[model samples]
Target: MADYDLEALSLGELKKMQKDVAKAIATFEDRQKAEARAKVEAFARDLGYSLPELFGTETKSTRAPAAAKYRHPENPSLTWSGRGRKPQWFVEALAAGKTASDLAIS
Candidate 1:
């Protein structure tokens, strides 16, 4: 709430102020999140359900494992889920005049 002449502050003073501001912001955000979580948990309890029961536990894996979509022709064991970056072998195969469809597991 206090007004600050930030432009007039020295470099060292500004850096210190920046650090203090960052810490304050982090603390404020944490406090706000905790308060919100408490309110949600209380409402869930009132509805005859625990917080985790209402909103599934964070420890549980939310996504199913990705299935293998592509496989190396020379070696059936070499497989790719086709999610992220293409593997080096896949790139080499493509460079050797092989179409992407040629690597399809199905």
Candidate 2:
């Protein structure tokens, strides 16, 4: 490992060095993760299971799409799963003094 006299470096040099260090760290982390994953997969195979069989593969739609947890008051078609970002209709309804419970599909 080469020693760096960071204190002696100019602002531009320091910035460049910082960028280089970040790239190196990212590469090192990626390599480490790949190695760890390989080891785990190998162990799983030895135990008579593939990696996905051991860890479980991510399904495109996990356990069926989340049922609509919230629905628009005027439009039943406009619904939300209450998972990700609030929909525009949901936000507008809130702004219009509608509580989340008021929009429940049930």
TM-score of 1: 0.55
lDDT per prediction? 0.93, 0.90
State the lDDT of candidate 1 residue by residue for 1-106, as single tens digits: 8999988999999999999989999999999999999999899889999977877886966799899999999999999999999999999999999999999988
Model 1 RMSD in Å is 4.3
Which candidate's lDDT is highest? 1
Q: How far is 71's C-alpha from truth in model 1 (Å)?
A: 6.8
Worst 10 residues of 1 by lDDT: 52-61
Q: Estimate, for each residue in 1-106, the C-alpha lDDT of model 2 and write its tens digit.
A: 9998988999999999899999999999999999999999889889999977866885665577888899888888888999999999999989999999989888
Error of 1 at 12 (Å): 1.1
Backbone clashes, candidate 1: 0
**Alpha carbon lDDT of residue 12, candidate 2?**
100
